[model samples]
Target: MDAHTVTRIGSHDKDLQELFCDYVPQVFRRADFRRWRAWGQWSDDYHAYALMEAGRVVANTSVMRMRLVLEGREVTGYQLGAVGCLPSHRGRGLARVAMNAALDACGDAPVLLFANPTVRQFYPRFGFQPQRQTLFTTTYDSVPEGPPALTLNLDDEEVRAGLVALSSEGLPSTERFGARGYATVASWPVANGFARPLRQLGSEAWVFAGVEGETLYLDDVFAREPFDLRAWIPRLIDRPIRAIRFGFTPERYWPGAVEAGEDTEADLFVRNLQLSPEAHRFPIMAHT
Candidate 1:
């Protein structure tokens, strides 16, 4: 422990970023952090506080500074992520050291994080209270179908550029609780199962979604201008879906959607903000 030191690194530090990325998969098996960084999606908003030994990251907690919409009002906030210590470093309080440094860097901004079950008890020690999110869902009904949505690959330079522009101007899916300026962070979902991207309304709108069984999971949507989501949803459906589950609050888009129950997001914790149950959900794709 005497040889350990904490270091703060941002996305601009290629060497340190690589070290963090290499350590990430050891904790988060499916996070393609390196690939995401290579795509140039790691923005300056993200920073990592790492406990280093001999210049190698042994424990880390990353933060993403963001503009969050809380109960329809905009506020500055931070989302903590990628928090873990190497197997050998666990139980030595190294993770706590990294987390404390990250939280201090947040500088009083409301902070939130998703924790794994294993660390559910750890966050509460840092003034974080568990917060439950609402799951919005609605029964699917048959509608007049249009041509299927065209799949746009993010790998395509033109498509990526278009998305970036739209993301900068797009309205939050829900004013209750969501994020602004989140284009780069969204690449995580694009790499995960929600790989399909669809653009409509002359490419002014885009949707990221995937299907499982009789359900269509709408991961995220971006549009330069507010549009009729209910009316345009029928056009986006290519297969049968008896129900739709939204990854973001649906009050602004689909007024008829009902609160199903607690969202799948477990072990969620927040500090310096009151997030009442069923009020709204932090947009899924916006999770750091």
Candidate 2:
């Protein structure tokens, strides 16, 4: 016989908050929780449902509110984050309990998550189908005129808003608009000075990236002007940059050296179709 209680804890629950904060570094094992704690930013809108056993959190899953747009219509959904169970708590189905509780709390909104390839098969049983993203690659030499560049400093609110402003430049094509009201922004910072600022051509280029190896992978891009991304490739590098990659591609197509392919490098699994899968992409900047 097992006895445990399930509770949804937000920032207000001080004691459980401390316990969960301690538990994350243990289960995740790879991320720097210290940086996350140092940020000192907590979202009351994000909730973690945990299985409490003997006064300790054993299994947990976080649920986040998402205000999405599908074909220009407003839609609501939720994103699942940091789902795991303590090593000793495995095989106990505590994760399942926490997940179900999250879904119920979310009512009927769709639930989405980015899952690793190894555990990709686990979400389907819970009704999480794979969502596809379009990828673009190109190697170009033409240096075309483009919107001036602007450095995206996470420390600066204006810069962050400029990044968010790109979502509304013309029409809502991706999921950044859905994340407008949510403070769940999380991303790998621009490092090594491969690049400093996210370039913009009058709100055209919504991007953040640093080069690695010889390839300049734009952490993400959403430039709808003229549509051909190859024209903007040359502007991305100050010294020398080789091939370019898109973290997320727009539904519209662009000509030139750019090549397109449907890929699964980053997998999004959704339990509900609250947001249509057609030409859908959650921007890299909106990661939680």
Tens-digit lDDT track of model 2 for 131-225: 77656667744332445355556455565455545544533334322344433344323321223356664456555654655666665554444
- In model 1, where do residues sit more than 4 Å from their true spots? 1-3, 192-201, 276-278
Task: Write down the worst ten-residue block by lDDT for model 2.
Answer: 187-196
lDDT per residue for candidate 1 within 36-62, as digits (tens), equals 776788788898998878667889999
- After TM-score superposition, the amount by which residue 115's alpha carbon in candidate 2 deviates from its true location, in angstroms, is 0.8
Point out the worst 10-residue segment of candidate 1 by lDDT. Answer: 193-202
Which candidate wins on TM-score?
A: 1
Given candidate 2, what's the lDDT at residue 224?
41
